[model samples]
Target: MNSKLLARIKVDAYCDKHLFYGLTNLNDGFDDSRIKYFSEKDFEVVLERVKSLGIGIFGIEPWKNGHYYDCKVYESHTSDPTDATWYMTCFENFKKRGDNIVYAASYFIPKKLLSE
Candidate 1:
């Protein structure tokens, strides 16, 4: 499969909601265990997609945030509420319970006035 297309698909799937970026527990911790990410080669591709179509970035002021922000993706295994290492690779058994959620962080544009 084309890597770019794959990356686009991942972003499209995750952006089902109005959020420009967020975390969710939809992908079962199995077959699709691949952590959807936007770094290295896929970073730019994913970012662009989100910027053009993503919502909730400015929460009704899209022009304020400059459309969207640079986003990073991460994944977790166990659904343990005690785990705070979301930045690190996760590998537990919450998949069986269908609780492995993914995480994402996007750097919002610094507070700035929109140039009309």
Candidate 2:
């Protein structure tokens, strides 16, 4: 898991959770003006900060590299999302239960993202 990829994932997860474009668009709890200052450099800083805070990041390299579980595949016969994946299930779950359903699914983010 590369740091850049982890940062990208973090951004994606944040957007998915908050329904926003970027930190600048976040307004759920914290002050958007304050949170909006998170630049790419801030991402790196936060990555380091999280490590120091004792959070461990974990993920399979193949998965992080865009592979999907066979049992979870529905898009294609292959391991790639284009071949088949759990995307539809995710969508349906979201539609039925909203964002809370996403929290029920597991996430595997790269540990390298936490490395200094």
Candidate 3:
């Protein structure tokens, strides 16, 4: 996507408390363990065709902190916690049954704003 298109999308997605990006891959009715792992070379050869499609491709990873079961949908269905795509990712199983819940909040602005 071009800068103009991306800018417009981000603006609309992040504009208000009642708005958010709804994205998910869970509940496919199949086991996620069946997902395969590929080497970098394997992926480069496989996905090379999509590079010319002029689309943005992203990957998901877990936040360092947090203790959810399997998936963490950043913003809830009704925007309970906060409104934003936030960061969607998986969580590892706790070492003990009584582990404490933790959270580290931060924002990632693409560019630094300059003073006028």
Model 1 per-residue lDDT tens digits across residues 1-116: 99767654554444544333443433244323443332222323333443543221211101111223223233223343222233222222222234323333332222221111
Error of 1 at 93 (Å): 33
> How many residue pairs clash (N, CA or C atoms closer than 3 angstroms) in each of the candidate models, in the order given?
0, 5, 0
The 10-residue segment with the lowest total lDDT in model 1: 56-65
Candidate 3 Cα RMSD after full superposition onto the native fold (Å) = 14.9
Candidate 2, residues 7-116: lDDT per residue as tens digits? 76674564344332332322233332223323333333433433343432221111111222212323333343321124433334334533211111122334443232
Off by more than 4 A, model 1: 1-34, 56-116
The full ranking of all candidates by TM-score, starting with the best, is 1, 2, 3
Candidate 2 residue 59 C-alpha distance from true site, Å: 12
Cα-based TM-score, every candidate: 0.23, 0.22, 0.21
All-Cα superposition RMSD per candidate: 16.4, 14.6, 14.9
Number of the top candidate by TM-score? 1
Better of 1 and 2 by lDDT: 2
lDDT of all predictions, in order shown? 0.31, 0.32, 0.28
